[model samples]
Target chain A: MAKELLKGNVAMAEAAVRAGCEAYFGYPITPQTELLEHMAARMPELGRAFVQAESEVAAINMVYGAACTGKRVMTTSSSPGVSLMMEGISYIAGTEVPMVLIDVMRGGPGLGNIAPAQGDYTQMVHGGGHGDYKTIVLAPASVQEAIDLTALAFDLADKYRAIVVVLADGSLGQMMEPAELPEMQPLKKQLPDWAITGEPGRDRRLLTSIYLQPEDEETTNIRLQRRWMEIEANEVRYQEYFLDDAEIVLVGFGTAGRVALSAIRHARAEGIKVGLFRPVSLSPFPAEALRLVARKAKAMLVVEMNAGQMLNDVRLVTQGACPVDFYGRMGGVVPLPDEILSEIMRLARFTPHDLNGHTRAAWLDRLEVVRGAK
Target chain B: MVATDIQNAKLVYERPESLADVATHYCPGCTHGTAHRLVAEVLDEMGIREHSIGVASVGCSVFSYNYFDMDFVQAAHGRAPAMATGVKRVFPDRTVFTYQGDGDLASIGMAEIMHAAARGENITVIFINNAIYGMTGGQMAPTTLPGMKTTSSPRGRDVETQGYPIRMSEILATLDGVSYVVRRSLHNPAEIRKSKKAIRYAFETQQRGLGFSMVELLSSCPTNWGMTPLDSLTFIEDKMVPAFPLGDYKVIDAVKSMKWKEG
Candidate 1:
């Protein structure tokens, strides 16, 4: 297919449809609304299901129900809306039904503005919902990558019977980029044995999260843990740029990662020996890769659109092998290439005390000094 | 009782094929079993066991999926209607219904059920209104009467403090999307039969693409009500019925004009 200029949200919606999404249930939330709107237009024309639910709570439950039928189903929302969906998300996760979710993240702990932020890094990658279940979290840095990851989300969801989240920020959702759309996949003719398809002749099927029995729930949890172990072993994905002979490493994901990539190129030109390590699978955290990067590099700077949420994970993986630093923009602020470039420049002139656990606090202190800047 | 003559004799009564052979977890004398039997019988009679999908809402009825011989999904508290909407929209030809209790339907799930009725999603809701939370042990439900007393409202439900009961059938009947809305009871055999008939009519309405349908069965929670089985039934007749009247609140013209014989 020829590359077409497409907005991230629209491209993702079309990608999901082409990926054989049989149903979509979502409410209007900024940045992610375009995805739902596109599905509203496309799904019906495709003779599939589309429901604009009353709330994100309803939308996620609807997604949960459709997922029970062993069909490729999806729902999209921004941060606050995704917060409302946590209850149903936990249910869907606990039930072990497969579904795709796109979180075009915007700001805040409250009803933050509709601008871009990586605030949901901990929430989506780490379990925001209750209990012991892991969602496959994919962070796509560009519109094209968003389209590719959107298609991948469905396959990963069905393959592991897991919830696969495409975590994008507002800028990625709104930005237009040239991307080739994948050919439409044919819907499945055969339903999975566990699918609740209302077929009478087959032994009846059920989809539920409730394991009232303590031992039974434990067994199920262990099974989920084992599946997650398999996922961690097989599905770790990351992109490394100029890491072969580098001392300063920049770590980020999604938009922040892309911005760092630009900074790395500029920093390398300045003889900073800076490299970019961008994790694509945010959940499985590319721990070993980061550990490897940490062993070789003197310092690492983690960049994000939030108050360094992913930094916590980076620290855990690095395990004090090397000093780590943080730079972030909170509440709808999108970090620019120059801002990261400066952070990388700062890392080049780094002193031993500069890259400590107090890294976030010192950055926040400096951040408050400015009125509004990325 | 002679097995020798059983082959020649007529079987007067038997468990509905839609119901599992095992015993239910419902407390002895609770009307949830009766309500489940009514729904199961209706599904079996209508021959939709194979084509049906049941959403079991949280509460005593949450285990309804285990009892019904149909594709089922247990929903989060009060989210059954939304789940049913998802299932029904995906499989338009499938018969989808939600079996929810008073607390599940009237309290936490008020928004979901109201909106499902408002959308007229061509699904049936079998709402069991026992006026108190049975699963959680005597908590006051939204349908709990003004003066009714339970564990949560042990001093009696004060209209001044807790407010009056909500008539869901009447409330849902006002929506344009709703095709059939009826309130029935299981206090007596006659009412049980009528409830079954209404359940049938509700499903038939859905089958005919007549939009949303519901049968609110005024059930009894003897253990939670702190009364004997008979006294609980009497309480439902005396106090509950007056608060939540049993009648057809809304029978859309299409449903009213159309003939539906009990299968």
Candidate 2:
């Protein structure tokens, strides 16, 4: 299909439809409402199911129900709404049902603002609800990436019979950009053997998350751990840019990662050897790939819209191979590219005469001239 | 010799084929076992057991799947209605139902049940209002009578503080989408027969493609009520009935004109 200008939320919604989503149930929350609205309008025309649920809790359970039928199902929400959905999400995970969830993250701890923020890194990658279960987390950095990852999420969810979450910030949800949409996929005509289709001449199927016996529960936990280990081995995805022979690496994901790319370009122009390492999957966390990058770099700078939640993951993977520094802007504040550039320069140990033999004062004068031209 | 003579004479009171042969974990004298048998018998009679899916809610009936002998899914606490809505919508040809308790349906899951009914989901709901949380050990439930004492309300439920009991049947009947809404008791043989009829009606409403249908049964929890199995039945008759009246709160014209086939 030809490239079309679309909002991030709309692109993701269209991508899900193209991926053959059979049902969508979601409650409206800011920064993510467009996705629900689009699904509400399109699903019925395609002879699919759509429900603007009473609440996020109800929406996610509806997804659980449809997923029990071995069909593609989804729900989207923001921070507080996602909190309400934790119970249902955990149930879906424990039952090993496959579904997709989109969390267009906003500022939080409470009813925070509807502005963009990456405060849900811990909640999404780590187990937010009460259990030893993990959902596949995909962080998209642009409108096109959002479309691509949303489609991939369905496949991953079904491949492992686990939930897949597309974690986008408010800016990624609200911003408009040109994207090439994927071709529509045909819906599955046959139900899987594990699905509860109420058909005769087959053994009855039961989809449940409860295990009353102590030994049974322990077995369930062990099974989940094994599945997670497999995911860690096979599903780790990350993007490396200009990392060959670089001394300083900037680590970020989602919108923060996109911003850091610009900082890396500007620093490179100023004779600084800085590169970018972006994680595409946050759950099976691209830990091994990050360790590789950490091995080559002398220093790493982690930037985020929140107060360094992903920083902890970076530190763990790096394991003091090199020093890791964090620069963050929280409470809905998005860090500017210049701020990240300055942090990268400081972490790389750049001095006055480091920028192509020009002093700091001369480099500042050149930047002012470039700004005037713009 | 008596058993042989009875077996040779006639097969009159055999268990329903839809009811599994496994033993249930229900407490002695609890009506959940009875409720399960009623539903299973209805499914057997309607000849829909092979094509019916059940959703078991959290609470005393959480393990209802073990006794249903059909495809079943367990839902999170209070989310059975939402889950049933999903199942019914995806496979409209299959009969779907939810088995929920007062705590699971009327308390924590109030929003889910209300919206499912309002949307006119083509599903049946069997709500067991036992006045107290049985599985959780005698805590107060939404259907707990104003002055009824529970472990959480040791001082005899204060109506001023805890509020009044909810009449779910009446509340759900007000929705335009609901095609059948009834309240029946399971304390006596006569009421048990009537409850069976109501449950069958609820299932028929779903099979006929009518809107949402629900039958609320006022049940007993003898172990938690601090009474004998026999006394708990009496308590349901003398005390529970007055608080939660028994009758059809909502019956559409289609349901009233319909005739039921005998099994």
Computed on C-alphas against the true complex, the DockQ of each candidate is 0.83, 0.83
lDDT tens digits, residue span B114-184, model 1? 88999989999999999888888888889888888888888999999898888899999899999999999
TM-score of every candidate relative to the true structure: 0.98, 0.95
Per-residue CA lDDT of model 2 for A215-293, tens digit only, reads: 9988998998999899889998889998997789889999999999999999999999999999999988988888988
Please provide, for model 1 over A66-178, each residue's C-alpha lDDT reduced to its tens digit, 9 standing for 90 to 100.
Answer: 99989999999999999999999899989999999999999897998999998898888888899998999999999999999999999999999999999998999999999
Give the runs in model 1 whose Cα sits over 4 Å from its true position. Answer: A351-356, A369-374, B1-7, B260-263
Q: Count the backbone clashes (under 3 Å) in each candidate.
A: 0, 0
Model 1 residue B217 CA deviation in Å: 0.4
Error of model 1, residue A288, in angstroms = 0.8
Runs of candidate 2 with Cα error greater than 4 angstroms are: A350-374, B1-8
lDDT (Cα) of model 2: 0.90
Model 1 lDDT at residue B9: 92
